[model samples]
Target chain A: MNILIIGAAGMIGSKLTNRLIADGNLGGKAIDKVILVDVVEPTAPADAPFATETMAADLSSPGVAATLVEKRADVIFHLAAIVSGEAEADFEKGYRINLDGTRFLFDAIQAADGYVPRVVFTSSIAVFGAPFPDAIPDEFHHTPLTSYGTQKAIGELILSDYTRRGFMDGIGIRLPTICVRPGKPNKAASGFFSSIIREPLAGQEVVLPVSEDVRHWHASPRSAINFLIHAATIDGEKVGTRRNLTMPGLSVTVGEQIEALRRVAGDNVVARIRREPDPVIMKIVEGWPRNFAPVRAPALGFRSETDFEQIIRAHIEDELGGTFVA
Target chain B: MNILIIGAAGMIGSKLTNRLIADGNLGGKAIDKVILVDVVEPTAPADAPFATETMAADLSSPGVAATLVEKRADVIFHLAAIVSGEAEADFEKGYRINLDGTRFLFDAIQAADGYVPRVVFTSSIAVFGAPFPDAIPDEFHHTPLTSYGTQKAIGELILSDYTRRGFMDGIGIRLPTICVRPGKPNKAASGFFSSIIREPLAGQEVVLPVSEDVRHWHASPRSAINFLIHAATIDGEKVGTRRNLTMPGLSVTVGEQIEALRRVAGDNVVARIRREPDPVIMKIVEGWPRNFAPVRAPALGFRSETDFEQIIRAHIEDELGGTFVA
Candidate 1:
């Protein structure tokens, strides 16, 4: 089966691509060819045996999605999207790429004629807004507080509609914040979660935007990749008409995360974190949902990292070669 | 204050226009002028007090909304949309008119310098899908089962974003299905609710699509107009950042509606209703939400007709001079 991974250069996208190549197949379906498309060319696996093609192009452009899906991929992992900060900052760019780009891809698939690839779309927990109960239930309404969340919510609706129309087999997996995300700090409002741990572990100081009590939902990068794989292989019968599923994740406060980091690393590592409260970031964080019940995803076989420790360990293993430099 | 009403020729649109004209002001602010727009020329009021102009053009067209809003209307009532049945039958048309038309209006409003029109967008209860509990709360996520619902849901998101960015002061009022809609039969899936009562009272035969057990949310056309008016005039402070509010309505079953019809027009009129179970229609009906718990809208002073009987009476009073020809 031929496979395609859009936004293959991003964290989750790159990880999932490597896993797919490492396994050489998805749930026994042998991948003969893999197409990796992103805004920037993704680094190819050094020992990849499969026929891998890396293409750099803006997917939002007309005919780009159709051109990418021309060979009729058996599976398409659509993990590409502008992050929360960028989306919030550049509204037109965000909608063009996130909303219009997703729609274009769905339309492209429909136009492909009888080629209904298993589309595993990566949505975010940002889809849920605040004033939520302690743990947001699976059946909660999507009242996104941010433009990014709204875009993802809209994308979910479109995916469901296109799937219902039998244009394609689509599944939207709403992922939690990936904790201890490997690589340098980024512009995401949630970036502090990782920066506190990642930067501190490298003996660098990182600012804490909000209070330690500020809580959020989280999963490791590995769990996110696992979710995509599971979404790709899951029986479409079980999902029924509802194509979007909120994946399971650990709900922990910033204090808990800091404590976990202290336990994993040491008091010295924890001391590298600086407390700097910003009211703007606090207001945004306060409006965000802290956790989700995600009953459906687990019942449907999707899983998350066991604990924050496992999340940290996965980051160390994947990014630091099982060792964290002090 | 200059006010603009899109879809001014439609049932709710025309009534809202007349109501605004009669009231002469909204929420204590006096109206200075009114711009009525529709696909066809609107029926001008016989004796107009305020300056009123009717322009016939498709709002979905490029530059139409910008041209309409060029003078900078103080308030914009975007009530135009393709009905559910039409939208479902023609997906492209649905997205084109509902989605594109809304975006154009929002963009037009934003483009006008020093123009911050209070946009009262008419959304529908169709935004909520089935598997609904006995009463859907304000927090219920939008899981629109039909293309029409999807379009409305998307529109709500866009309205919220545009509002958040201070592009325009917008509010999305998700109206319940208008019962006893005073008019000839139209192509809407929910039209049967009104047709069963309206046609029978006019001494015409009407078919019941589903069983009496089929329950759904409803409000009279008067109530729908009331919602639009309230949404337009209500203080933005009361709404805060949550721009969309589910308008209150009565949760009535098909049996209750028929019972109300019988009570109002006697069994002779009810006898004119024929039972014809349509699985296709039933399936569509099944996916619709039966009730909503619109706590916010009411707190902010939006009101709906108390009962189905009153709703029927309202139809008679407003449309037929409180007398039936039968």
Candidate 2:
């Protein structure tokens, strides 16, 4: 099977690429050729079992999407998106990239003369709005409060409809915030979730902008990659018409995350996280969904770590050579 | 207020137009001019109190939408759409007209140099797919099973996002199946719902394709127009971020509708509804929502009649000039 990963330069995307290469197969079909695309030229793996090509392209620009999908990949992982803060700040750019760019890709595939492929799209929990129940149910409405979430929700609708029309086999996974994200912190409002943990473990100081009581749903980068793999290979018929699903995630408060960090790396690592109340971040975090009753994804064989301790353990083993700075 | 009614040739659009003309004002603002647009030129209301123009235009065609909103009408009622059955049979046309057409209009509004008008978008209950609770709540997720529903759901999302971004003052009202729709029987799967009530009172026979046990949500055409008007004039601040509301509707079984028909026009009119099971139509109806607990729309002052009898009486009074073929 030929594989294509859009936004392959990003954290989760790169990890997925490495995993696929290591496994050398997806859904029992050997991945013979891989195409990795992003806004900038992606860094290709130095050594790999299969053919690899890195292409730089902006999908939001008219006609670019058609060229990207000319290969007619057997499987496509669409993970490219404008983050929440950027989408909110730059409205036009946000819609252009998130909404129009996605539509262009879907339209390109639909117009590709019967070339239907399994499309695994990365949707975000931002598709939900606040004033939510303690454990938001699957049936809760998608009344997105932000432009980014609205675009993702719209993408979910399009994916479902196109799949129903047999134009593509599409599965959209609403991912939880990835904890202990590798590398430098970006501008995303949720970036603090990762930085608080990653920075402390790296023997650096990081600020906890919000209170420990602020609970959020999370899965490790590894679990998110696994979700993409499972979504790509799953029997789509079992998903029926509802192709988009809220992935099962561990719901933990900031205090619990700190506790988990203390357990894994001890008091020294825990002491690295400092309290600094940032009202802007706090206001943003307050509106986010706290937890979800994601029953379907688990039923479909998409699994994540049961707790934050395991998430931290995985991060240490994967990123720090089985050891944190402590 | 300068009012623009897209799909002005259709039943609800035309009635809404006449209602506006008759009232001579909308939400306390005196009506001055009305622009009516459709695929064909709408018949001008000869004695209309306001300045009126009926223009033939297809909104899906490029530049047409731009011209329609060029005047920047103070209140825009976007009621145009391809019906469900037609959209199902012609997928490309559905996306083109129902989806792209709406987007084109919205983009036009966005591009009109800060001309943010009150956009009253007419969405449908079809946006809510089947397998609903006995009384579907306002917060129920939009998992549309049909292309038509998908299109409407997408429109609602766009409206909400656009409004949130301050591009427009938009309110999307999800109307129930319009009972006793004044027209010849159309190809829509839901058309029979109205025909049984409409044709029977007109001394004509109509088929009851589904069983008596089949329940559906409904509002009179008057109520639908009122919902639109309320959506157009209501304090948008009250709606907040969730701009789309499932309008209040009466939940009635086919047996109840028949009983109302019998009560109003006697056994003869009830007998005019011939039972002929259409497996295809039955299959379509089976996937529709049966009831709703639309709390928000009513709280926001969008009201509907209490019973099906009032619905029949409304049709007789409005369409048949105060008389049915009793």
lDDT string, candidate 1, A284-309, tens digits: 78887888888889999999986788
lDDT of 1: 0.87
- After the best TM-score superposition of candidate 1, give how far the Cα of residue B265 lies from its true spot, in angstroms: 2.8
For each candidate, the DockQ is: 0.72, 0.88
Per-residue lDDT, model 1, residue A6, is 93
lDDT of 2 by residue, A182-253 (tens): 999776778889998899999999988999999999999999999999999999889988899999999999
Error of model 1, residue A117, in angstroms? 1.6
lDDT per residue (tens digit) for residues B1-326 in model 2: 79999999998898898889788999999988999999999998998888998899999999999999897899999999999888989989999999999999998998888799999999988888767898999999999988999999999999998898888999999999888788899877888889999998889999999999899999999998889888889998898889999999999999999999999889988988899999999987898999999899999999998999999999999889988886
All candidates' lDDT scores?
0.87, 0.91
Candidate 1: tens digits of C-alpha lDDT, residues B1-326: 89888999998988888897788887788888888999998988876668898889798999898898886888889999999888989978998999999989998887778788899999988888878888999988777888989999999998988888889999999988888788689766777988999999898999998999999888988899888888888889879877889999999889999999888889889999999998888987787888888889899999998889999899899988879855
lDDT of 2: 0.91
